[model samples]
Target: MSVRYAIYFAPAKDTPWWDFGAHWLGRDEHDNTALPQPLLDEVSPTELASITQAPQRYGFHATLKAPFRLAAGTDEPGLITGLRTLAQTLKPVALGPMRVATLGNFVALIPHTASADLQALADACVTGLDHFRAPLLAADLQRRRIEQLDERETELLSLYGYPYVLERFRLHLSLSGPVDEAVAQGVTQAVSAHIDRLNTEAPLLLDRLCLFVERNPGTPFQRIIDLRLQA
Candidate 1:
C-alpha cells in the first residue's frame, strides 16, 4: 500500500485563488468535480488543456513538504498531530504581490519578494515532519534524475529528501507543466488577468495549511485536511 502525502498551502475555499486555480486547472479541490478551463485567445483551448493536465491532478497548491510516504511505524494520526503542532506556532504570511513567472517550462504565480516567515514555515515543514518520511525508493530517485543534480542539490536530496529547498525554494502555485517557451510570455499575460482578479479583494494570505493525499500512483491528490494558524 504505497501512499504519498504532502503538507501544502492551499488557499481557502471560495477565495479567488482557490476558485480560479480549481477552474483553470479543471479540477475542483472541494469535491474533485471537473470544471472548465480558462478560455484564452493567446493559447488555444487544446494547447492550454494539454499543458494543464499535469498540474490539474495535484490541484492548486504551493508545496511546503513535497509528497512522500509515511515512514515505518508512523501513522496518519501522528502526521496530523505533527502538522497541527507546527501550525499553532506560526503566523499567517501575507503575500505582498504576485505575478505570473516562468519556472523552467511552467508558468505560475511568484511573490514580488520572498518573506522570511514563509521561508521559516517551509523549512519547518521539510524538517519537522521529516521523521515521518520514508526513504526515497530507487524509482523515486530515478524520477528526479539524481544524476543531473548539482553537488549541493544532490546533498539536499539526500539530507531533506527534496532537491529544491532552503535557499533554492521559490513558492509558486503551478498553472502548467512544460509549456512552449515561444508562447510563454503570452501564456503569462493570459494568466495575469486571473491574478489581477485576485487583487481586487484582500491580498491573499497564507492563513492556513493543507494536507494533500495521494492514495496511489496516478491518482489525483486530494486536499483532505486544513489547519488554521493560531496566530
Candidate 2:
C-alpha cells in the first residue's frame, strides 16, 4: 500500500482546545468533518480558507513522528502494537502556556517556554519506532527540499528520513501555512485573540499518541486512534 502513517499529539476530542483548533482550521480530523471557522473582520471567509488549506488537510496537532511508509517487513498491525507498547512506558508531559507565533512564513501556537520532557517524548517516538519506517523515496527527499536545510539538518535527514527530528524539532500546532505578508499581522492578532479567549489556565498535556493515516496521496489525513500513556 502507498498509504503513510504519522504519530502526533492532539488534544482529546470535545475539549475546548480541540474544538477551538478544529473550528479555526475548519475541519476535524477526528471524524473528517467540515467545521465552521471563526469569522474575522480582517480576513474574509474565502481568504481564511485559502490560508488554512494546508493545515486543514493535516488537521490540528503537533507532529511527534513525521509521516512515512511502513518498512518492507512491517505492517499496520505491527506498527500499532509498537505504538501501544511505547505509550505504556511513557507518562504525560506538561507543556506550559502557549503563545501565537510566526514560524518562518506560517503561524502556529508554540510553548512560551521549551519543555525538555516534550523533546524527549518526540525523540523517543522518532527513534523507537524507526524500525517500522521505510527509507524516504527520491521524490520524498526532493519534496523536503534538503538543499535548503542547514548542515546538521541535512545530516539528520539522511539518517532519519526527516530533518526536523530530535534536536531540530520545534513542537507547534500550525494555524496557517505561508501566510501572505500583507495580512500576516492581522491573522496573527485574530488567532491570538481567539486563543486568549480560551480557558488556558491549565497547562496542555501530552498524554496520548494519536495515529493518523493518509490512505492515498493528496488526501487529508484522518485520526485513526489514540494510545494513552500509562505511566
Candidate 3:
C-alpha cells in the first residue's frame, strides 16, 4: 500500500498569470508560462502533451514536502493536524518570478533563482512532518539505490522517502512524462511557444500552497486543502 502526503503552493486565478482554461487544458504547466524562454525551448511535444493532459497530477507548484507513506498505524486526520500546526508559523514566501525547465528526464517550472524564504518553508515542513513519514520500504531503498544516488540522497530517502529535501530542494511545476533525447527537443519547442504566449511582460507570483492528496493509487490527485499566505 502506497500513501503520500505533500505540501505545495499555488497562485490564484485573479493574478495576471491566471488562466483556469489553460491550466485545466494543459494541466499545471500553464503555470510554467512564467519560466524563461531558453528553458522552455528545450522540451519535447509528446512529453509536454503527456504532462498537460494531467497537469494537476504533475505541473505548477513548489513542493514543500515530497510524498511519503504514512507511518504504521497513522491516520489522515492526525496528519492533517500536524500540517495545520506547521502552517501556523509559516509566513508566505514571496517568489517574485521563476523559470521553467527540464528536471533530468522531466519538464517543470522552477524559480529562475532561489529564495531564502522558500528554503526556510521547505525545511520547516520536512522537520515538522518527519514523524509522519514511514521508514523506506526495502523496495524503495533498492530502487533508489539502483539509481546510483549519492550518500545524501540515500540518507534523505531513508529518512523522508525522497533524496532531495531541505537545502537540496528546488521548486518545480511538472510538464511532461519521461522521454528520450530525440523527443525532448520537440517537446521543448512546443511548450516554449505556449509559454511565450502566456507570459508576456509581468512577473509571476506564488500566492498559496495547496495540499493535493490522491484518494488512491492510479486515481487523480485532488485538492484536499488550500493554504494561503499570511500577508
Best model number under lDDT: 2
> Could you tell me the lDDT of residue 213 within candidate 3?
67
Question: Better model by lDDT, 1 or 3?
Answer: 1
Displacement of residue 34 (Cα, Å) in model 3 is: 23
Instruction: Write one digit per residue (lDDT tens) for candidate 3, span 102-155.
Output: 788766666668888878888877888888878777776776664788878767
lDDT of candidate model 1 versus the reference: 0.86
- RMSD, every candidate, angstroms: 1.2, 1.2, 5.4
CA deviation > 4 Å runs, candidate 2: none
How many residue pairs collide in each prediction?
A: 0, 0, 16
Candidate 1 lDDT over 88-185, as tens digits, reads: 98889988577888998888888888989989988988988899999999888998889999998999898888999987788999988887786778
Superposed Cα RMSD, model 2: 1.2
User: If the candidates were sorted by their lDDT against the true structure, best first, what order would they fall in?
Assistant: 2, 1, 3
TM-score each candidate.
0.96, 0.96, 0.75
* lDDT winner between candidates 1 and 2: 2
On residues 4-117, what C-alpha lDDT tens digit does candidate 2 reach at each position?
Answer: 999999999988789888998999898899999988887889999999999999999999999999999999999999999999988998875778888889889988888788
lDDT against the true structure, each candidate: 0.86, 0.89, 0.62
Pull out the clashing pairs in model 1. Answer: none
